[model samples]
Each structure stands twice: as C-alpha cells, then as structure tokens.
Target: MVGIVVVSHSRKAAEGIRDVATEMGGDARVEAVGGTGDGRIGTSPEPISRAIADAADGNGVVVLVDLGSAVMNAEIAIEEAELEEEVVLADAPVMEGALNAAVAAGAPDATVDSVRMAAEDAQRVKKFG
Candidate 1:
C-alpha cells in the first residue's frame, strides 16, 4: 500500500489534514508531520521524514508540505534518512494535493507515482495566474 506524509507548521493543521485523509483513505496508511521549529508555523524535516519512513514500509512515500520551511525540512529529512523507498514531494496546493493523495492511496493500484500524478493535477487546479 502507498503511504502519505502531510507536513504543516501547526500540529493542528497537519492533524486536521491527516484526519480528512484518513477518513477518505479508510484502511490506507496516512501520517502527519507537524510541530517543528518554533511551533508558530513550519515543520521540521526530521520528524516528517521519520513519519514518511514509517508509513512507507516497503512501498514508496509521498510527502505534502504546507509551506516553505516545511518543504525544506522535509527535503533535508529525506536526504538524512537515506530511505530506500522513493519519496515524492508534492508541489501542489496543500489541501487539494492532500485530498488527491488520499484518494490515490485508497485506489487499488495506488503507488507513489500515481499519488504524485494526482498531486500534480491538483496543483494545476490550484495554480493561479
């Protein structure tokens, strides 16, 4: 099964997103990464990466970040972990990307590539001129 890691500055945001994804995903694996740095806003990469690793198991991991630091941190964590599983970072808008990822995860043929595709599509939908 595919694994999802949602990263946000506030624990609440991450948790909330995770809750929505969990509801949509059913038994699929979905994890949250939050409360990093000052806790005001911005997640640390280490914990986020760890969460991804745990959720990934053998399958690859898909990471979705809320903003700047969260993205940087997640990237750093992924590098530090040296995880064997493929880790795809979603450049899509947080909410749409996360929802798409959740749906992809629940799909029978869900994979990191599929999730990434869904996230990219969501991002396109969210993009503004």
Candidate 2:
C-alpha cells in the first residue's frame, strides 16, 4: 500500500487531514508531522523521516506539507535518509492532495505512479481554480 505523510504547522490540521483521508482510503497508511515551537503536535525532519521510512517499509512515501519550511524540512529528511522507498514531495494543496492520495490509495491498483498522478492533478486544479 502507498504511504502518505501530512506535515503542517498545526497538529490539529495534520490530524484532521489524516482523519478525512483515512475515512476515504480505508486502511491506507497515513502519518502526520507537525511543526515544533508551539503547543501543537510538533516534529522535526528526523522524526518525520523515520515515520515516512517506517510507513514506507519498501513500497514508497508521499509527503504533503503546508508551507515552505515544512517542505524544506521534509526534503532534508528524505535526502538525509537516502531511503530506497521513492519519496515524492507533493506541491499540491494540503487537504486536496491528501484527499486525492487517499482516493488513489483506495484503488486496488494504487501505485506510486498513480498517487503521484493524483497529486499532480489535484495541484493543477488548485492552481487553475
């Protein structure tokens, strides 16, 4: 199964997205990485990477982040780990991408390619509309 990680500045946001995705995806692998420095759920690159690695196992990972910092941190984590699992940092809007990924994951033929395509399509819609 495809693994998805949602990174945001707020824990609630990450959790909320995960909940929605889970409802749609049904048993899909979903994790959260929230920013630190506040009372909210927080995490660093290392922990996020570890979560991604663990969820990925051997399949692959798709990371969705809220902002520039979150994206950068996730990227750094991916680079540092050098994991074999294909990691894709989605440029799509957080909620939309997560939902799209969830839908893709629900498919019996879900693959990294399909999930990436869903993410890209979602991003395009967000960008255009």
Candidate 3:
C-alpha cells in the first residue's frame, strides 16, 4: 500500500485535492501539506515532511506538488523526512495526478515506483471538453 502526499502553496487547495482523492475510494493513506506556518502563500518543508510521515504506512510515499516553491519544498521535505519508506515526486498536475496516484496506491500490489508512474501518466488524461 503506497501513500500519497499533496503539497501546494495554498492550504485549501491541497486539502481539497486530498478530500477528492479520499472520496474516490482507496485504502491508501492520503495527506495534504500546504501554506506557510503563518498561513502565508508559501510552502514549508517541516509540515510537508510530517505529512509524508503521517501518510506513509511502512510502504513508500508519492508526492504531488502544486507549483512554484512547492516543488523545492517537497524535495526538501523528502530529504528531511528521511523515513525508511521511499518518497518519490511526480511531475504532473496536482489534483488529477493526486487522484490517479491515490487510485494506484489503493491497489494491494502498489509500489512506490508504480504509484509515481501512475501520477506522472495522469498528464495524458484531458480534464475538460
């Protein structure tokens, strides 16, 4: 069971994405980390790391980032977390990728690399008409 971590510059956006992923039905652990400690429009590594720890249930974790500093912060968090579970970053759209990853994570045989690939492949699915 792979877990997912959503990182965004806006707290609401990250949490909203997590809610949707959760509602989609998955056994994976999903968590969101966003906004600065002061609630400013920025990302922090500390909370992001904690989110990864919280979501990871021994299995590795996959991270989906919104944009801008979120990427850098996620990378930092991955290193800072330093958990035994491997953490991988997906280069895909935030919400869609998170949902895709969550679905993959739900699989009984989901792996960190597989979940990351699923999230990255989400870029192929068009969102609108």
Candidate 4:
C-alpha cells in the first residue's frame, strides 16, 4: 500500500485530516505533520521528514500540503528524509486530496503514480453541486 503524509499550518488541522483519511484508509500508513517545532503556527521540514519516513513502508509516499510554506517545507522534508522510496507531492487540496489518496492507497494495486493521480483528481470534486 502507498503511504500518505498530510501537512498543514496547524498541528490540529493535520491530525484532524489524518484522522479522516485513516477512517477510509484501513491499515494504510498515514502520518500527520504540522506546525513548527516550538508549536508555532507554521510548517517545519524536520517533523515533516520524520513523518514521511514514518509513513513509508518500503513503498512510495504521497504528500498533501495545505497552503504557502507547507509546500516548500514538504519539498524540503522530502529531500531531507533522503529515503530510497519515492515520494511525490500531489497538486491537490489538503483535505479532499488526503481522503482520496487514502482510499486509493488502500487498493491492492495502488502505486505512487496511482495514488498521486487519485489525490490530484480531488480538484474536480464538487461540494455544493
């Protein structure tokens, strides 16, 4: 199964999103990472890297980030982790993308590209439609 990492500016938000994703992910590895080391409302690469490493199960990881610095920090985290497993940042909304990716990750045939594509597909979801 593909692993997942949810990155947000608020630790609470990341944990909440991870909770939701986990409900649909079954036993899939989903890690939440947010806020600075000092509990400030910001993103940090260290914790994100740790989360990425923790989430991986010899499979690739799919990262869904919230806004602004989360993206940059996630990128840096991926580089810092220096894992042999592949990691890709999905160009999708943090909440919806995590849900979608989680479901896709649970699939038996799930792969990094497939999970990332599933996350990116969330951009087409209609909430009020």
Candidate 5:
C-alpha cells in the first residue's frame, strides 16, 4: 500500500488531519510533518523528509500541504530525501485529499500514481449542494 504525508503550518492542523485520515485509512501508512519544528507557525523541510522516510512503504508516498511555504518546503524535502521510493506532492485540499489518498493507499494493491490520483480526484468531489 502507498503511504501518505501531511504538511501544514500548524502542527495541530497536521495532526488533526492525520487523526481523521487515520480513522478513514484503515492500515495505511500516514505521517505528519508540520510547524517550524519548534511549536511555531511555519513549515520546514527537515522534518518533512523524515516524515516521508517514515511514512514511505514500497508503494511510495503522497504529500498534502496546507499552503505557502509548506508546499515549497515539501518539494525541497522530496528533492533532498533522494528516496528510492517516489514522493508526490498533491495540489488538493489538505484534509480531504489526505483522507482520500490514505483510504486509497490502504489497499495492498494501491500504487503511488493511483494514490495520487485519488487525492487529485478528491478535489473534484462535491460534498453537497
């Protein structure tokens, strides 16, 4: 199954999204890397790489970010990690995308691309009118 990483300026936000994803993901590999690594409001590449490494399975990892530097930092983290497994940055709603990706990724047969597609597809979903 693919893995998932959540990135946000707020550690609480990241952890909250991870908690919800956890409830929906079943056995998926999900991890969160957020804040300035000092309980501040910001994003950094350092812990992001660690989270990617920790979350990554043989199926790779999909990263979801809140905004601004979180996306930029996540990109840098992926580049710096130089991981053998692929890391994809998702341009979708952080909470919803992570939940969708996590659920899709929990399947043993799920691939990195498929999990990413799930996150992307999540953006198109309409909750209600």
Candidate 6:
C-alpha cells in the first residue's frame, strides 16, 4: 500500500486533515506533519523528513501540501531523507487530495503513480453546483 503525508502550516490543520483522510483510508499509512519544532505556525524540513520516512513502507509516499513553503519544505524533506522509496508530491488540494489519495492507497493494487493521480484528480472535484 502506498503511504501519504499531509503538510500544512498549522499542526492542528495537518493532524485534522490526516484524521479525516485516515477515516477513509482504512489501514493506509498517512502521516500529518506541520509547524516548526517549537510548535510555531510554520513548516519545518526536519519533521517533514521524519514524517516522510515514517510514512514510507517500501511501497511509496504521496505528499499533499497546503501551499507555498509547505511545498518547498516537502521538497527539502524528500531530499534530506535520502529514501529509497519513490516519493512524489501531489499537486492537489490539501483536504480533498488527501482524502482521494488515502482511499486510493488503501487499494491492494495501488501504486505511487496511481495514488498521486488520485490525489491530483481532486483538482477536478466539484463541490457545489
């Protein structure tokens, strides 16, 4: 099964999103990482790297970011982790993409590309008519 990481500026938000995603993921490995070491509202590469490594299970990891520095930090974390597992950041909405990726990752046939694609597909989701 593919793993997932949800990144946000606020620790609460990241954990909240992970909670929601996990409810729909069903045993899928989803990690929530955000804020600085001191619990400030900011992104940190160290914790993000740790989350990436934690989420990895020799399958792959799909990261979902809230915005801006989150992406940069995720990139930095990816580089610093030096993981052998294929890790890719999904360019999708944080909440929606996390949900989609979580569900896809729970599938037995799920792959990194498939999970990432599912997350990116959230970009096309319609909320209201």
- Using lDDT, give the best candidate's number: 6
Query: In candidate 5, how many Å is residue 62 off?
Result: 0.7
Model 2, span 1-129: residue lDDT tens: 888888887778988998988888877898976767455544578767776887786778888888867888888988987887788887888888898888897688888878867866776663544
**Regions of model 6 farther than 4 Å from truth:** none
lDDT of 1 by residue, 3-112 (tens): 88888888898889889877877776878878855666667766886788788778888888888788898889878878787888888877778888888888888889
Work out the TM-score per prediction.
0.88, 0.86, 0.94, 0.97, 0.95, 0.97
Please give the clash total of every predicted structure, in order.
Answer: 2, 0, 0, 0, 0, 0
Worst 10 residues of 4 by lDDT: 21-30
**TM-score of candidate 4 to 2 decimals:** 0.97
Which pairs, if any, clash in model 1?
9-42, 45-73
CA-lDDT, candidates in order:
0.81, 0.80, 0.89, 0.94, 0.90, 0.94
RMSD of every candidate to native, in Å, equals 2.6, 2.6, 1.2, 0.8, 1.0, 0.7
Task: Kindly list the per-residue Cα lDDT of model 3 for residues 65-104, writing each as its tens digit.
Answer: 9988999989998988879878899999999899889888
Alpha carbon deviation, residue 92, candidate 6 (Å): 0.3
- Over 4 Å off in model 4, which ranges? none
Tens digits of lDDT, candidate 6, 55-78: 999999999999889999999998
Candidate 1: list runs displaced more than 4 Å: 37-40, 126-129
Comparing candidate 1 with candidate 2, which one achieves the higher TM-score?
1
Candidate 6: worst 10 consecutive residues by lDDT? 21-30
Candidate closer to the true structure by TM-score (higher is better), 4 or 5: 4
Better of 3 and 4 by TM-score: 4
- Show where candidate 3 strays beyond 4 Å: none
Model 4: per-residue Cα lDDT at residue 76: 90
What's the CA error at residue 124 for candidate 2, in Å?
Answer: 3.7
